[model samples]
Target chain A: MDKKKDILSLDEFSVEQINEFLIQTESFAEILKRDIKKVPALRGKTIINLFFEPSTRTKVSFEIAAKRLSADLINFNTSSSSLRKGESEIDTIKTINSMENDLIIIRHSDSGYINYFAKNVPVPVVNAGDGKHEHPTQALLDLYTIYKNFTNLKDLKIAIIGDILNSRVARSDIKLFNKMGMDVKVVAPSMLMPEDFSSFKTKFANNIDEVISDADVLYMLRMQFERQERKFYPSIKEYNKFLSLDMARFNLMKKDAILMHPGPVNRGIEISGEVMDIETLNKDKIKINAQISNGVAVRMALLYYALS
Target chain B: MREKATVLNSDDIERIIKRISHEIIERNKGSENIIFIGIQKRGVPLAKRIKENIESLYSSEIKLGKLDISFYRDDINEKIKSDVNITEIPFEIKGKDIILVDDVLFTGRTIRAAMDAIMDFGRPKSIQLVVLIDRGHRELPIRADYVGKNLPTSLNEFVEVKLNETDNEDKVSICWI
Candidate 1:
């Protein structure tokens, strides 16, 4: 497929485009330092945030970014909308498009819902998060955060752990990390591993010992108990047996391995309470909170490039 | 390759300033709080000359400032080898009838970026652009409010403006290179 025409997936964006986007993002970074943080770049432009699932960070970050660019924002919650009354996904998006929105930022519960919506929507569609599919912006922000810290992406060994099967973040990060020529390893319980994961061409590890050893970055995804209809493991104790990132495991990992988690973290379930309490893990290396702010910068760059 | 030069001299510059000053006074109705902000390098000298002419004619001083729009420039990183002169603005420009003076108005990106930079100082009461030469073919939606000469040119051609105070000569030329 022609690269520019392949907007259905975020994987189509080349490394050059990502680099250019980062450089473009630096132009707007000065806006954050100002007292009245706003730019008139997208003035009078309308942006629709259509989130089918509940998200505080992604939704609010996008809203703030749109507002900062002076774009008119309309937020739609699927639970409260006609979607709850069984309105088809296409019908909902078409209805929103009819309002003459310049762009649509969507997060849905079903995987590939964003791809489906992007195919249907006339306006530029930004994938916020789609089921267990992909969250491109989050991954972009993740990359941006990493780039800000390290000033490089090539040759970095990043280990993505936890519920890989249900993580849209992991899916997007895996693609982006690989595309940027970084070495990636997915460490997760075998039950939570995707079947076609090898297509990503990254290493898979069932043991955390092998995965975390000499790793540059450790990206931990939250285990979604809500996604599994039946309990995947017998008990929280059983789940922790395979999944928990305890102090011992954390100590075994490389000293420079930056621990990260996309939050609403189950403190003791996936990562131990003591691990979360570690000053270096929580304060220094772990910059998941800072990632929320970087989302605006990345999204601003994306919107500017795709629209302007 | 011959070292060719076309002479405009100081007299030509004096004539342009005289014409521009008359136009400014006529439109502004007495230069009250009217300020001239030059877009670095050549524009600053041109602005200073215009301010001098306005002061001599009307017996009143027009507030003059200089703006170095390098930091606000979009092409700074892309065209890394390009030379950018020193920028200096002497006074606050808030709530003044600001006139951005540039030697030549071409693609308009410079003006657009300059306007973006100008907002950082403080909000101006009104901004009116005055250019020494308005060579058409604007990539951006920008226009000079007061133009000395409107020279229609193609995209490939270059418009050069030289001021005696800065360039050791005074001239406006269109070079086909």
Candidate 2:
């Protein structure tokens, strides 16, 4: 597939593509450590962050990535866009998309709508987070962080804990990590598990200790209380009792296994604060920060590779 | 059918590299603050050759670094997927006279990207470009500081540099359709 046209999902990415991206991201990560964190790769180009959903982390990282690449940027959140005045989503996006802009980073609440925008627009489209469908960039940054730690992705055991039915990050991560040859498994209650688990090289478990005893990486997805999915479990306390990453379960994990979460932790619900605080990654920083730091590099790689 | 011509033979390659090394020493005044940072593939061998020549001339050591400008290129973001190479600058470049070595100098964009990539490492006191062949058709305002051979060409022509370090041979050729 022509990734430069649009980076819509991880499914279209091959092992060569992912590895190439990770290698390129290593340079961007090194750039982040320098006194100057900007590059002139996309100087004459323009980028628009057309985020229909509210986001502080993803949107900010993308903005930083674009700015670092010297691309002209425009931020478009739904509340400030024409969609606030009863304008159709497609119409609002199309109206703002002119010949001046070179790329559009879109985040919408509707699944698979990125393809609609990519089809209608002539410029490149990057899927920031499209509903519960996929968050390709987030998945990429996560993979970068993990790849940096483990050095290799194949045959490694990755335990993805917490909400599975509603996390956009988990959706992309499963597809990508699997494509990279990792043994990925989901640990969630029956209600939180998706109806189909046979689509990829993934396993499902209703208990945490039963699945993570030998896991090399522990990835946590937020409980997604905001999605407000109905009565998955009796209560937060009960969910924590059964599935949360407490000290006991944490000890069961491989001593050097990485702890990762796409930030804004639930504190006491999906993962315990104590377990999440044990920082480990580049320069001894927490994995969450590492993930955030990596987001910029990975996005820079994507933007530079897609636009260069 | 296509037309082909041999530009520089193996012995010519060695002699030109030796001459370029001496010229670099003469211009940079003894190669004290200078380092050779090669572009990927063939540039590495050319840089190494220059380094060896300089080392033997004055019996002095000089550092060598490799700079890959794949992602830094302007056409890297096009529809086609290109191979990404690794950049290894083992030592610092700040305040030193830097010489960027490459095999071909046609569009000048690759060297432009290399200069930009070098800036990210640190501000080098000065930067110079050395090319084995300078087939003149520049899209940007760029000119090499040193050249082995200045071969003029049209837009449709391609310069092929084959060296022992990468391709299992030693020669420079030109192809035209």
Candidate maximizing DockQ: 2
- Index of the highest-TM-score prediction: 2
In order of appearance, the predictions have TM-scores of 0.70, 0.88
Candidate 2, TM-score of its B chain:
0.95
Candidate 1: where are CA atoms >4 Å away? A1-8, A238-242, A247-256, A274-283, B1-113, B120-177
- Cα-based lDDT at residue A235, candidate 1: 74
> How does candidate 2 score on lDDT?
0.83
Q: Please, what are the lDDT tens digits per residue for candidate 1 over residues A234-260?
A: 677876776678888877776656777
Which candidate wins on lDDT?
A: 2
Please write out the lDDT profile of model 2 over residues A20-100, one tens digit for every residue: 778878877766766667766677788998888889999999899988878888886678656778898667666866547
Off by over 4 Å in 2: A1-4, A280-286, B1-3, B56-59, B69-84, B107-109, B116-121, B137-145, B152-156
Measured with C-alpha atoms, the lDDT of residue B46 in candidate 1 is 84
